[model samples]
Target: MRRNGNSDRLSPIRVYEWMPVEALNTLLKQLEKEKRSLENQVKYSALRLEQESKDYHKTSRERCTYLAERSQVSGSYQVSKRQQMDQLPRMKENLVKTGRCNSVNQKTMNAMRGPVKKISRSNHLPKLNL
Candidate 1:
């Protein structure tokens, strides 16, 4: 019963018959190794990101504190300067009328002496309190 080359005949090999349990186990182990490696990389990246975030927050907080302090100091300085400017004309008038130097006018005349004197005078009680 020799068939022609064009005749339809079933092959002897079965598709599912090649399944080996050892080969399947090895493939699963390889997949697990890859998953573990990927997980480690993700963990490392997350840790680095967290550390960077903490550092950024710390730096931002320090900057905010510094700016706040600077603003406070500048505001005080501007207020003191404005007060001195307002009193300058009156002090000059007093000096012209009195012809003798007074303590208040002396302090006003030396307004640019230093911040220490200003701060000390600000904290001290006036002569009226004595």
Candidate 2:
């Protein structure tokens, strides 16, 4: 006959079986502490993921805004350049007219000087000399 609580399968495997109740309580507390630590780590990881997602979205929005602004600036620059190009021919025509006026004035001055010189030379010649 097997002794009570002494069966081969029912026998204690480790010394904890003979440990005080306080020691078991301490072990239970340690397991709870480890469980809480694991839970906190999971929470922190989840929060980090959420924060990263938000940051990514914000950065994407900022990038889109920057691109839009750049496009607008480029468009304005192109329009202004086109306007300037369109006005260039008129500006060139005005410049040509001013140059022509200056040339005409120079020619008039040269022609006036030639006649005055001729008259002065004629006056200085002998009265009877042809």
Candidate 3:
């Protein structure tokens, strides 16, 4: 090969010999920097995934607790409703008995007041013939 000062035409062996020590050192430093950057990215991705998993589990637990509490409250409400329904007939019977007692009380009150009669004004005045 002729010594043409063009770098593109240099043979592999000549290129290796021609590369400066400083250039090789800079390339190695850049490769190490890139490797460290890749490692940090992988570590960050792993931490993020772990955090997401924890959040998901926490929300799932909260959802379960909320559902359990809601079910308990609804169950109590249903039991109270059933108890009210069961007592409906008794309540109606008590009302009917009270109505009958009220009729008797009203008769006694009227009896105490005495029988009502119509009175005329002439009955209070003495009879005088003109």
Question: Which numbered prediction scores highest in TM-score against the true structure?
Answer: 3
- How well is each residue in 1-130 modelled by candidate 1, as lDDT tens digits? 8766554343323332475878767878999999999999999999999999999999999999999999999999999999999999899789767965546645556565642244555558656654
For candidate 1, give the lDDT. 0.79
Model 2 weakest lDDT span, ten residues long: 112-121
Model 1 per-residue lDDT at 108: 58
Give, for candidate 1, the lowest lDDT window spanning 10 residues.
8-17
Clash count for each candidate, listed in order shown: 0, 0, 0
By lDDT, is 1 or 3 better?
Answer: 3
Off by over 4 Å in 2: 1-23, 100-130
What is the per-residue lDDT of model 3 for residues 90-129, given as tens digits with 9 covering 90 to 100? 8877876786434544544557676445557888998899
Worst 10 residues of 3 by lDDT: 100-109
Model 1, residue pairs in steric clash: none
Candidate 2 clash pair list: none
Give candidate 2's whole-model lDDT: 0.82
Clashing pairs in 3: none
Q: Using lDDT as the measure, which candidate wins?
A: 3
